[model samples]
Every structure is written in structure tokens, then in C-alpha cells.
Target: MGSPICPDCYDYLGHVVWQYHAPELWRRAIQDVSRQLAARLGVPVSKVSKVVSRQYGRTAEMQARGAVHFHALFRLDGPLDEGIGAACGVGVDVMVEAIEAAFSRAQVQAPPTFECDQSRVLRWGEQIDIRIVREGSRTDDPDAPITGEQVAAYLAKYSTKDTSLAVPDGAHVHRIKQTCAEVHEAAILRAESRRAGEEVPVPVDSEGRDHYVLIGKWAKELGYRGHYSSKSRCYSVTYRTLRRRRARFQQVTKSRCYSVTYRTLRRRRARFQQVMQEETERAQRAGKPVDLAAVEEALLSQEDESETSVVIGVWEFVGVGWTNQGEVEIATAAAARAREYAQLRAGKQ
Candidate 1:
């Protein structure tokens, strides 16, 4: 379920309220909505262990209307009490009803404006979108269920987007600019009032300090103040954990700093072939078949032990690829020789 602030709240906050205070108002409204939802679901605030809930918030802008809105994902685990209703858990229909009821009941008191008092009630817009996410389908697909991957990717895409309003000529841009100008004018008025030792029209905090003077600071965002992305603590894995896991993987797979010369490689290959030949000869002399699996396992164990041995040498860098056509022919001849050797070893086995 997604809900956007009403037009009246939008205009009042963007034009009349200070930008610094806008975030606080938004936080209050979101909390109110959450509280209402919890109340509807019969979840106690003090005892949160009964129901596990996760929420993620995404702030987005409408290109045509140039207004900012929120997109949120709510995952509810259970009602837990089987005695209340069905055997497994709460029904999808009941959850949807709770969402709608919460949205309707959620309201915030708007700050006083020049034309009106502070008693005005602000609520969500009429256009509330509610969609049930089921397993194995998408929100747009009515026949299929919603997959976890799809929902995660959808929310992540919106979370990383720029929250700035779109560029378009017309009343939307004009109104945004006009509201910013109003904020600036209010700042100037507050400053002048302070200098003259007269009362300011803007409200003050408990400390008796003017709070609306910082409204012009967030004019770039059209006074829509909120984080681009927010989530509950238990919603997902932390970035630090992911980075640490990656670091550990890299450490495990990182190659040791050692140099290998062409001569060394040839020597190792020759030693391997000689060992295999000796083993085959021994098996024939004993009139017994060679155990290929045992031979492979022994070779692997030897390799693992040899990995810790330090090879001390400084080799000059040779140019990549075959230096000449003769070198390429030589490489091909060596590969053919290796293949012949392998075939001979296979026949012996």
C-alpha cells in the first residue's frame, strides 16, 4: 500500500513551512500512519515480538505534476494467534482492509499559515494504491503471484533514483519557484523583525528561536524534505556485513606473490609425467591395475602442500601473445606432444 500527502499539505509545507521543519512533519505523519496500522492489526506497541513487520520507504517525483511522493513496501509476518481466526495466519483480505483503514484514520495537524490557523487537519490524497504481493507473481500480473526478487529490485530501483523535480516549463515550475521566493521573503522578514525587536509571524521552538529562517536552504528540492531511502533495522542485511564477507572471499582466493619461469614449468610437467610412468611400471610389475582415483588424489594432496612453498625469483616481463609465427608453431607442437603423452598414459591405465 502506498499513500501520498494531500495537495493542501503539500502546498502548505512547501510554501508556508520552513524546509528544515518539513522533514519533522513528514516523520510525524509516517509514524501516525504506522501506529494506525499497528492498532488495526491488533499488534501491541510494547510487545512487538508477536508480529514481525518490515518497512522500506522510497521518495519519488512525478514528472508531469512535479510533486514528490513516497513508495513504501510493507512485509507482515503473522498475527500469531490461531485462536483469533484461521489455522495458519492472518488472511490477505484482512491485511488489505487494515491498510485501508489505517490510511483513512491517519492524519496530521498542519502548521498555521498566513490565511489559516494551526487547527487544519492534513491527510493522504484520495489516490491510494494497494496491491497484495503473493508468491511467484508480479504486482501487474493478476493471475500470477509476486516474487521476492521482483519486489526487491522494484524498491531498490526507486530508492537509488534522484529525488529532484523534473525540468518542465509551466505552472509547476513557476509555483515551485514562487514558493521558494516566499520562503526567502519569510527569512528576510524574520531577520528584519529580529533587528527591530518586534514579533515575527513565524513560529518558534520551545527555546524561543525562530525555526522558519532555514526554509530557503532546501529550495532546490522544492521544499520536499525526506531521505531518498529509509528502512527498518531488520529489513535487510547491513552493508558492513556484505563488505566483510567479500573481503574474506578475496583473502581466501588471492594468489601468493611468486614468479614462475618457463624452465620451472617444464621441470614440473616432466616430473609429473615421470611419476605417472613410474607408477604405471610398478603396477605392471606387480601384475595389478593402476588405481587412477588414488593417483589423482595423491597428486592433489601434493599440490596443496606445495602451494605453501616459496619460489624466490625475478623474471623479466615477456610481451603477450606469440612473438613470431615460429613461436606459435612451437606452442602448437608442444600441445600436440602433451596430447600424445596423455593418450599413452590413458592406454597404460
Candidate 2:
């Protein structure tokens, strides 16, 4: 759960940048480890069985000082059954060596640094911990239950998280906002370190909006949005495909079309509808007659029945559109005209 970072010494931009690349770094590290194992065993990368199947995994914020580090969990297919043990050998010393080697060699370059300092570096934290699977064991203990599920879950969770000033979500909005403000106030803090910079952290809870307002510095991220994960093509199925399959199955079961579209729909005359509903309720309570005004109000108070009522505005880049009161009024008027025309036709009949 810890990376080699001197909280007092590490650069803030470096910390934020690392958070941005952590997912890629982890993937590369795992791939390198697999390659190392394959080379040692004299087998193909595909042949070596992945003991842990990462159904889900995440990364979380690990802070040293104002700087950030990482703690990750990776889920596997099963417990460390055979391939990992055979690859790393029997003792924990061998496991540690293999892990260290993979992490040490694994490097992610920053985009073409022209500066004299050239921050494009390849270094992992010195604080490396490797453990084997054992139930009811401590995380620090080398024999803890590092199950496939445990690793995947751990990595997946933190994959989308950063330090206090990293990103925004419902659970930690207050803390994130406060930290962002602090970082903003400190001139010592680098631009990237101030707030998630390029990396966008997703919320642990999926039901809520990916809000960035509570943590304003994150507005630069275009709404706390970024790629939360990076996996090799060989890893497994994708989330989108998985969801599509589930939806297809549901559609088939329900005997409906599987196609779906995401578009903006406007409902106009909402206020008028509300007023009509209220009046109807009052009439019911008073045992009064429900007449033409009530019926017309209810019918005309909707966009589907009248096009001119609500004005819908769309922002192409942002992909959002909504209706205002003016549009609602126009649509209501149109609905009333249609009703009048219908009544005229009925009179002629």
C-alpha cells in the first residue's frame, strides 16, 4: 500500500504525474513480471496461466507528506496456485527479488522532455512488499491471503483515486475541496500537483454524478473524467462488451429490441402540469366538478402533445441539452390550439 516517497522531499507535480501514470506503470510492471517469469521458465507469455483474474481492481492514494504515492490491489483468477510460485520459486526472498526486478526495470517515460533536467525518469518506490496467499493473515505479513480477488479489488479501488487534492467524488468532496484550496494557496505547489491535473478520479459509488464543482480545481479535468484503467488486450473481456452482453440477454428475455441510444429529451410545461395536478387534487378533496380548465391544463401541460412549448438548448461539446420556461409556454399554447381544433372537428361531426 506504500510507495518509496519522502513526503517532505518529493515534488508535488511529480506526485500528481505519477498518479496519472500509475495505471500504465502497474500494467507494464505486471507485463514485465509475466515476461520475466516466461523467460525464466522458457515458455510463451500466453502459456503461463494467470493465477489471479482481475474481475475488478483499484488504486488508492498513499500520502507521504504533501506528495502522493500508491497502494494497489489486483484480482486474479484464483489463489496463488502454481504459476506464480513456480515462477518466483519457493521462498519469499525469491518472490521479493522477482518483484523488485520487475518494478526496477519497469519504466514509463514522460512525453519528450526538452528541458535540461528532463524529468522523463524510470524509478519505482523503494518500499516494495510481496506476499503469498494465506487466509486470516495480516497485510504486512508475507503469508496474507493475497487472493486473486484481493489483488484485483485493491488495485481497482485505488486505480481511480488520488491524494486529498487529487479528484472529486461524493464521499470525499469536503476533504478534496479543502485540500485543493490549500494546494491552490501554496505557491510552492506545482501546477500539476494542485488538483488531479490531467488525471480524473472516479467515485467509489457509481450511482452519483461525477461532480467536480465541490472540488473546483478539478474543472481543468473537464468533469473529474479520465481513463481509470489500462489493461493488455490479452487480459480479458471489456466492461463495455460485458455490459452489452448483459443488456442483450435482458432484451432477449423481455422480447424487445436490444438497441439503445443516448439523447436529450425535453419535457415542457412542467410547471403548468404541476399546477393542474395540484388543482385536480384540491377539487378531489373538495368534491368539486373536474371541468374543461382542469382537463385542458392537464392535457396541454406536456411537450409530447405540443412542440412549441419548450425550447431545448444543446451544447455539442458537452453533450447536454435542457428546456426552459419559455419553451414550455409555447408548447402549452400549441397543445391548447390542437385541443380547440379537435373540439371544432367534434362539433362538425
Candidate 3:
């Protein structure tokens, strides 16, 4: 079950606009972090590159209240040669302080809406958390610092998070979609007026304007118009680069990087599906019933390895979902169970 919505009126326009500009806000926030880091380390802003470089991996999550939260892993490294090792001089406490100051300094002047008739200042929320990622397993101490794998897992889990919210009476999830539609209608009228050369009074912010029309296009996402996950250019290998590498590169390279890579997880998923099919086929040939639990255990016990294989077969498109009503019912029941489990876990969080 989702969280209960409040009875009070919500500024739907402001909410959507803030969600629309979240990417820009994050960009400016990171810049502020760099400035803060420079000040903390007594280095000039322009010369900070010579001393250290800042890199981050971020994933955006939507709260049950329909607000965006970011889980980011920020690291400071030396200029070019010393690598992440040089960051030891700055320490985690300084990073935490820089993050706090950055959050305070980061603000975006949102576009004016019909309801408010003035530009709004959007800032990060008060609930801030900073964690130090240690190199190895955590100690038995209750306050032991978390490991890199723990941090990466936290980000990976939330990057695929379920989103649900409804404003007004807060009874149905469709209410948020309805709100997006209403906002879209107003924006359409405003655009029409501008095209006809009529004077449409829209407040102009000193920073500039944002396109509000995207709210309707992303209505299913409750007006969030930004990426679910992003990272700095130097943080890790990008998907485009990885795809290029997979095509022509015949060698394996080693480099210090994030513990989790989305591309690797995707490849593992395809491999898992292939293994399951093989196991089922083997069981069928022996005239034996398939044991799903045993198959899962076998997969988990095996090491993560893959080989180059020749795939010579005629493949066909499979239906997106169950092909029959009986199977549909079973799938629906399974989905309901999964949703309930997710709700339980969310409550624990």
C-alpha cells in the first residue's frame, strides 16, 4: 500500500516545476560542492583542478510524498597521476562539511506558475545524510562505516524504485496524472497566446525560464522529467563507451571504478535466463519435473563467468505478457504478492 495523502492543498504547479528542474539543480549543487571543497582545503576555485578533482555517481528516488531525493557517491581524487589515493589528505569530515555547505548554497529560481504568479526558489530538503564508504568489510562496531558494495547496492536498488502518489483527496493514484493534465492544459493556452502575439503575463526569473510542457509527456512518472541515474564523465565507463568496447575490443582491462555497473548486471540477467532455459531443457530430456528452488540454488552457487559462444538459431518475438486468461490470473496474483512485499519493505525503511 502507498502512503496516505494529506487533505491540505498542494502546490501542484510548483511541485511539477521543481521536479522538471531537478537536473539543473543537481548540476549547480555539484558546482557548489566543488567551490566548498576548494574553500575547505584552502585552494582557489579555478586552481582546485590542480589539487583535486570531484566525481560523483547519483541516483534519483521519489518519496511516497512525491518529492525527489538523490543518493550520490562523491569522491575526491588527485590531479591525474596520484589517483583516488591522494584524497586521503582531505578526509571524509571535510567532504561532509563541503556537502552540507553545497546543499545550502544550491538553489534554483523556478518559473512562475498561474497559481503563485511569481518565481519560486527551489532548494534541497532539510533531511540530509552523509556516509563514509570504507574500503573493506565493516567492523562489528555498531557505528562502523559502510563498505563500497553497500553504498553501490543502496543506489542500484533505489534506481529501479516504484513510484506512486496522488494529491487532493489522496484516494487514487490517477489524481496525480489528472493534475499533470490540468497543468498541461494551462501551458497549452499560454503557448497559444504567445504564438498569436498576444500578451501572456508569465513571470520572468533572473535565471531564465523552464519548459513546462514536459509535465504532460511524463505524466505517468508524476511530473518527474529527469534521469533516474546519472554520473560524472570521469566517474566510470559510460554505456555508449561500453557498447563500443563490446563490439570491437578483444581484451579485458582493469581499472579502479564503482563496485556496480548497470551494463554488467544486464548481461548477468541475460545469462541467468539462458542458464534457466538450459536447466529446464535438461530436466525435460530426463523426463523429470523441474525444481525451481534447486535451479536457483545452483545458479547462486556458481561463480559469475561467461564464455564466447556461437549462437546459430532462428529466434522469434515472444509475447510481452501471458497469452491466456488463466496464466494472466496467475501473473496478476504473483504481482500482487510482490507489491505487498515491496510495501512491507518500504515501511521498514
Candidate 4:
């Protein structure tokens, strides 16, 4: 986990200070950590096959203590074995130490501006929690086993939340409002300077370049900027691939159903027409009335020979319905109507 320090610098810079660039800062931080871990493990950067990372954010109190914090997950290739290491041949314990070192070394330099006095150093919080994931093994903590499914669900749930929905009672909210006002004033000044053909001074960092902080653009987010979730190229299968697979499945199913139904219907129709033609020719040759019952029986016998027998059943009437009162009433009415129709068909109505 990484968090920003709420320094006194914010009094001058407002919420658009170095901390506002949490997204970029942590991106660099994670990269640094990965590089350091790879070097320690003796793995060449080109040979590294998999490195997955994701980021999640939470709003801090609006007071001076308020700033966005990040939750991150990292996965490396292979098991926790020395053989998997590249150069130094270290294991998981050593990798964890390398991460700690990287966090300490990772820092974000501020673009020299009136709002900031100096570049800010970034690091993880003191409460660093690291755990080893193993299959079918529970942890000592009350949270118990840390399965991949649980972790994914946890990250996904928070990633979709609205950051702007945080309560508006904190000091951070006040600073954000103040920053909005300042940004508005700056825009007006820039406009006037441009109309007067005057060169408006812009703040630059130590690199001697103009800092790009479009304060108005991020005012609604309280100047905090970063993606809720991100992943490396080789992390997992992409959304595009899943969608394509689903589309193909649906297409195949539809084609199969249509082809089967058309083939069956065509075969039955051809057989029926052939049988009728044969019966007509026999009647004409005999010069007598057609034996309709025998012809029908012959066709049915041919069908039985060609395919499986069609099962038919006649059951005695039993009590209607199962449990529901409404269903019982409907079933009783249906049974009475069925008996009346049967009697009429038998000429006994």
C-alpha cells in the first residue's frame, strides 16, 4: 500500500500539488519495484515472462490528513523456488526485501512551481502487509485463506466505486474548493495576458519545462488523478478475446439448430410425398377403390423400420393438481372438460 503525505506545502499549492499526481507517481513506483526485484532474482528483463499489477484507491479524510491511498497486487512467474531466480538465485523472502528497498528509493520530483517548495519523496506506509498465497492452506489471521478468487473479487469491487462520492465534510474538500477558485483566477489572468500580448509566466520543474497541471480539468475529482484499475500486457486474457469467444459460440449454436431442423423436415416431406405417389399408382393399376388403411399402415411400418419407435401413452385420470390451490382449481376444470370431449367423441355425450 502507498499513501501521500499531507504536508504544509498544500497550504500554498492547494490540492493540485505533487500528491494530486498519485496515478503517475505510483506507476513509476511499481515499475521501480519490479525492476529492483527482477535484478535481485537474477532474471533478465527480456526473459521475464509475467509481471501483473493492479491498483485500487480509497478516499482519505478531508482534513489535512486527507490524501488518496493505493492498494496494489503483484505476481511473478513460477513458484517460490531458488531455481526460478535469474541472477542472484534468491527466493520469495529476498524478493520481498527488494520491494521494500525499491519503495524507499522511489521518489517523485515536483515541477518547480510557486505551489511547491521542493520535490516530494514517495514511499509505502509503515504498515506493510505481505502474505504468501498457497492452495488449500488457511492463514493464521481471521481473514483466513487468501485465495486468488477472493483477492480478485475484492479488487474488482473497489475499482468500480465512485471516488467523487466521498462525504464532503473533510478538510480535503475545503482545499479542493479553494483550488478550484485559484484555477479559475489563473485562467482569467492567462486570458488577459494573451489579449494584452504579454508573456504570462508559467511554473517549470527542475527539468526546465512547463508543468502541465490542468487544475480546472480535475477539480471535480478534488485534484486527485489516477486510474482505478490497471494491468500489464501479459497479466491475463483480455476483454476482447472473451467477447469474441462468446460471439462465436452463439453463431455456431444458431447454425447447428437451423441446419438440423431443415434437414429433418426435408427428409420427412420427401418420404411422405413418395408414399402417396406409390399408393395412387397402385389404386390406378387395380382399377378399384384405394385401400387407404393398408397404405397408411404400410407407410407407418416403413417409418418404424427406418427410425426408432415413437413412444405414446394413455394414462387413467388421477387427482388433479399438486399443491397450489389455484393450480388445483385449473387442473380440475381441465380434467372435467377433457372427459366431456372424450364422451362426445365416443358418441355417448
How far residue 24's Cα lies from its native spot in candidate 1, in Å, is 4.5
lDDT of 4 by residue, 1-349 (tens): 1123553454536336644666666667666766776676567655443332222222222223445666555555442221122123235576567667766676665543333244444455676666654466434466676765655655766676555454344555666557655754665555556567777565444553235436556666566555556665434544665685576344433543344356655876787688778887986796534545445556555642324446789788876548688987998999999999998999963
* Stretches of model 2 off by over 4 angstroms after superposition: 1-10, 16-24, 44-97, 109-117, 135-226, 230-237, 255-349
Over all chains combined, what TM-score does candidate 4 have?
Answer: 0.53
Any residue pairs clashing in model 4, and if so which?
41-86, 42-86, 42-87, 43-86, 62-170, 62-171, 62-172, 63-171, 112-205
Q: State the displacement of the C-alpha of residue 185, model 1, in Å, after optimal TM-score superposition.
A: 3.3
Clashing pairs in 3: none
Superior by TM-score: candidate 2 or candidate 3: 3
State the local distance difference test value for candidate 2.
0.46
Error of 4 at 156 (Å): 2.9
Look at candidate 1 and tell me the lDDT of residue 151.
69
Question: How displaced is residue 319 in candidate 3, in Å?
Answer: 44
Q: Which ten residues in a row have the lowest lDDT in candidate 2?
A: 79-88
lDDT (Cα, tens digit) per residue for candidate 3, span 1-349 = 2333553465666666777788889989999998998998898999887777788899988776676778999887666333333444567788789888999779988766564467789888888777788898645565778888778778878876665422322543366667778877777777777777777777433443325655689877777778989888767756765775564233222214524467766876786787789878986796545545455556555634442335889999986877899998998999999999999999999
The sequence of per-residue lDDT tens digits that candidate 1 reaches over residues 1-349 is 0212554455534443433343554566555545654676677754432553424444554344555556667655433231121122545565566567666666655444332334345566688787766676445655566676676787777766554424455555566757766756665676677779886555665666445455566566666555656665444545665685586345434455545556546765776686688778877796555544345444544553444557889989877998899999999999999999999999999
TM-score of each: 0.55, 0.39, 0.63, 0.53
CA RMSD, predictions in order: 20.7, 22.5, 18.7, 23.4
- Number of the predicted model whose lDDT against the real structure is largest: 3
| Alpha-carbon runs more than 4 Å astray in model 1 | 1-26, 37-43, 78-88, 113-120, 137-150, 160-171, 191-196, 206-211, 243-349
How much RMSD separates candidate 3 from the native structure? 18.7
